[model samples]
Target: MFTQFVQQFGVTTCGTMVWGWHGRTLSSGVHHPQYGDCWLRLLAAPKAKAGGKLWDGPRLAAERFDGRVHKAQMYASVPHVLDDFAYLAELSRAITEPVCSEEPVLREEPALPDRWWASLQTDLDTVAHGTSDRVAVRQEWINRVVPQFLNVEPPQIRHWAVAHGDLHPANLTAGTPYLLDWEGFGLAPVGYDQALLTAYSCLVPGFVKKVRDIFPVLQNEDGRAALLVVIADLLQSASRGDHPELAPALHELARTAI
Candidate 1:
């Protein structure tokens, strides 16, 4: 199926998904004369599990944010034998360099424009209030993850907004600074994205300081609460043996925040 799909796009060679989690992705130099390069993602539609919805975030972002987001050029869907569905979305290749390398452990900060930050805040607000149906980031979810992973009670949330739920260095591009991976994008605690980026930058002291200096949210109470939530989420991922190297750092960070 994968090979056939590539053929439809006339792509001769396609690399494996650079970061495959909830879906599969591939990067390829397009064979078509009209297009140069592209990225493709195949995602499984939401199931009948706890949080099920038909909203396609990447598609929505492509439409709403347009030039600011990685462009979604084309997409198609296929029905599964069961009561589920799958989709293939092709996006325009990012022209700018990513803020950090694919493995963000040793990445250095990239120069970004002030306008990028301004646009990010505006876009996040638009998405959070945009007409879409998805699960809101409830206090219960944070409460559950915090105690289970960080072994501490959850903090109170003072604000909420639409966030790029998986905000980290790896998912951001510099120069122009376009955010990637909208699969997890949704309404979340205010400053959640900033907190997540700070958590991931714990290894790089300079970068951490830069992030803190740029985003004033890090100094406020609500921002601190959001950081605690991000730490708990990271700790939970660490417990599953994901990003083991960052576990200790995340633990210490969580301690300081708590």
Candidate 2:
């Protein structure tokens, strides 16, 4: 199916295969006769589960945003039904730089330069301050989950800002930084991205402090609310065996924040 998929693009794979969660998506680098290099991602899911706002995120991002930061440029996307499943194939300009980390949690502190940090601070601010009616996290969902996950009523989100939705270490590039995986980008609580990055970096206290210093909003009511929301979400994921190693640290952070 992938060979057939690439045949439509007139390209050939050049790099190692990368798989998304549960092998639902497959991504790799491709070399084109005219386009040189590009990224190809194919998402396979049941027909009923494939078409939605999140499914269209990369295309929407390409149409709506550019120059806000370094990111992939979508050249083409084709969605079609294959047997009982729906497949969405997206072709984008390849990012030559490696990601900061291969997974959400960083095993060690990243030795990034001042400009890299500056770019992240500036880019996140730019995106968060933009106006968007789309949503990354809903109030009703937060209200329902926070109590179950953290045993506390959700904080009223006083500030709602556009966000990347998922901004863990793996989604960001090293050296020259670029944000990846736009599938969850939309309106979320103010400082949601910063809070998420900090929450996932619980093992690295020094890096967490640096993030706190860079974004002083983490100390404000709105940022605190966002942090609580992110921690609650992480706790929920921990319960489900996702990043179970962070469970203890997350509980400790929850105590500090609460």
Candidate 3:
């Protein structure tokens, strides 16, 4: 797939391959003859479930949100099949800054200036205002997972808004707070993005406190509900053997929050 696209798109893969969770995605830094440096993510899934809003997320996001808060998307490709599997690719301007943390789930808080925090708040507010019909988090899914994973009475969701959908440490950049991986952005419970970050930062008490302090919504009923929902979702993921190390922390956080 890499060789085929490099030749077809006239791009040279300059960086080592970075595989995403479960090998679902393969990303590499590429240099294009005309476009210069770029980042390419090749997404793969079973052919039966290969294409959807996620396939075009970066392209669509580029149309609505500018590069100030996210990487500027350059191009997207139609599905390319390989027997029972299908593949698609998205290209965006390479972000020169390092990720906010070395990993997706923060093992420890990274050094971030107050100005960066302020910019993150501003950018997240902007993200919530983004319009999209996609449903990133569904009430039905929340209803089912919250009780199952959180073991608490699910809090009612009174508000809904667009969110970055995925805002973990890896998806965020350090210096100025650019959100990556727009594939999950859409309408979710209010403060979904904020709560998601908080859940992921559960192991870091200082970072969790700071995030809760910065986002007042975390103190409200709706935002609290959002936090539980995100916790439930992550716990579900952990149950499936994805980051099981987070299971204990997430469960502890859910207990305290509830």
Q: What is the C-alpha local distance difference test score of each model?
A: 0.65, 0.87, 0.83
Q: Over 4 Å off in model 2, which ranges?
A: none
Which scores greater on TM-score, model 2 or model 3? 2
Candidate 1's residue-wise lDDT over 1-258, tens digit each?
455556666655545444365444434434443565566444444444312332466665555556544423443322222356444545455344545557545456656677776766565555556544444467998979988878888897877777777778777666446677666666778788888988887887777777788778778887888889988887777778777778788888777677
* lDDT value, residue 156 of candidate 2: 81
User: Candidate 2, residues 150-229: lDDT per residue as tens digits?
Assistant: 88878888779889889999999996789898988899999899999999998999888888988998888888889889
**What is candidate 3's lDDT per residue for 1-258, written digit by digit as tens?**
877777777788899999987788898999987778998888888999976777767666777786546555566465589999888877777887889788778888888899888988988888788788888988888878899987788777888998888889888888777787888778999999999999888888999999988999999888878889999999998988777888888888876567
Q: Which candidate has the top score in TM-score?
A: 2
Assess every candidate by TM-score.
0.77, 0.96, 0.91
Error in Å for residue 216 of model 3? 0.9
Clash number for candidate 2: 0
Q: Worst ten-residue run, lDDT, model 3? A: 67-76
